[model samples]
Target: MIRFGVIGTNWITEQFIQAALESEEFALSAVYSRTEERAKDFAAKYDIPNLYTDLESMAASDQVDAVYIASPNSFHAKQTIVFLNHGKHVLCEKPIASNAAETKAMIAASQMNNVLLMEALKSTLMPNFRAVVDNLHKIGTVRRYFASYCQYSSRYDAFKQGNILNAFNPAYSNGSLMDLGIYCLYPLVTLFGKPNSVQAAGVLLSSGVDGEGSMVMSYKDMDAVIQHSKISNSYLPAEIQGENGTIVIDKINQPGSVRIHYKDGSVEDITVPQVKPSMHYEVKEFIELMKSGRVESTVNSHANSLAAMEVIDETRRQIGLVFAADLK
Candidate 1:
């Protein structure tokens, strides 16, 4: 079994741990939090033996052969580099790092250490996502791709009450685009590669972060539009328009249901049933790469992560969204 260490005690981290354990290829050996109490509390639920309050100690520990990092956006690069330098494989949660430059450094560290480093982008690895890609030829001559993921943040109420959480805080290197819009961008880049140019606009909160945003990525013969927000909800399904038909994706992030609407008034349901606890796919892939002695995933390759981050950097620039990490 591949021994795993987890950083962060948030809901997403909990989901990842559940998924990793469910895969049965991994054993949860360590948990790390900034505070001992928090680490103890988190580890208690999983019966995890090793609790660490220091990242360096956890990095140097023999308890873990790999780490799953779900820390805040700003901490992803530094934390991942520490683990990489210590020769631990890392499966970092996405938007790989705060910006393209940080992502490059993280990839460099992985290369220098010859350890497995994969971005935990669950969407791109889902069976249903592969189904979409495999069936792309049914819809010939693609012209436009539109995707939107806008769920009003549960923490928005707290923010409105004068509590600025990490979701809306620039110091954490987070906002609507980095948090939600990436769902759209990653898939787009995975399917079509990087676009030629990007045009973006967004609503920035007083905390110096975007609340909602839209980006239009221009390609040679097609344009992809993505809308993301943390202040509103959208029930619209994402669609890829082509001359012959349109591919409709139910959830841009999870892609539970995918269909095609053809011009001849015929419809096809093409979704491959996803594995339960969607994060499981990423964990399985991570372990497979580690066992195969590969340092990067062919699906979530370094080039793909860097391309996506470059798009995010351009989008932030267009919207005038700057994070303290960018200044540093």
Candidate 2:
């Protein structure tokens, strides 16, 4: 029952349309807003009968087949290649662009319109992030993977009373490592992958973006450290270290309870049962990969969104944090 269609009314698109109406596998239909009175007041506060201010007439509509796109990040690879060249199927919202050549041109327009393109990045389709990737073999010999997600930004007090908006705008590529350190680097590149070296530093916000940061990636014998901030607030609890224990991830953007902690001290809570506005498990894995026709996502893969956009373009090239779609 796909249907969908949405582009940004914020509050994370009203919590992804209230987790796509508690998922029967989605059906909302339409919503877009360049302002047809804020898209008919966000389609009459989410009854969503269809309202757009023309994004190519809701991507040349045939009444929507897919589109979640939470816009801004230089308009996610040209609005996901104009809704995958109008055939639809796109669930963007993440650092799926603004680098790595607009994520390889939105994964080559979802492989030249075969459709289905994910990356909603709800922490690796979190069932407590697949119970921390199935208890990571009981944390033995993993090495290290600390993550962090800072909060502090009720629009950073109107950007410290200067008012930059668009989340501290850098021409809408926004910051804090593309809005909260790509949720601690997409679950540390979905449980460790791309990192041989990264090293970073930040605290820019003179409208150059990145109001906070810290990175360090190097990996063969693992090293991860990836704190992030919108200007500070972390309750701590995002570890992975190993040699027989420590998984603990209370929330790297809704990991929602996970624990392991052993080395003989003994503790385990390999959380799995999660379903709520926890973005209904990435919209039920993007409608079960578009009803098994599939086009990407081996747990949000397009080679893990181009290796998390090449580790966010080498941590915004060693933390200078440039954007304007990284100079086109």
Predicted model with the maximum lDDT: 1
How does candidate 1 score on lDDT?
0.94
lDDT of 1 by residue, 1-328 (tens): 9999999999999899878877767999999999999999888989999999988999999989999999999999999999999999999998789999999999999999999999999999988899999999999999999999999999888999999999999999999999999999999998999999999999999899999999988999999999999999999999999999999999999999999999999999998976578999999999999999999998899999999999999999988999999988
Q: Highest TM-score among the candidates is held by which one? A: 1
**lDDT at 117 for candidate 2?**
91
- Model 2 residue 105 distance off true place after TM-score fit, in angstroms: 9.7
> Which lDDT value does model 2 have at 271?
81
lDDT (Cα, tens digit) per residue for candidate 2, span 229-282: 988898897888899898888888888888898989989887877647788788
lDDT of each: 0.94, 0.85
The stretch of ten residues in a row with the least summed lDDT in candidate 1 is 16-25
Q: How much is 198 displaced in model 2, in angstroms?
A: 2.7
Once fitted onto the true fold, the runs of candidate 2 whose alpha carbons sit more than 4 angstroms away are 5-22, 28-58, 68-81, 84-90, 93-118, 121-123, 130-143, 146-185, 189-222, 225-239, 242-244, 248-259, 274-280, 284-307, 312-328
Off by over 4 Å in 1: none
Compute each candidate's TM-score over C-alphas.
0.98, 0.34
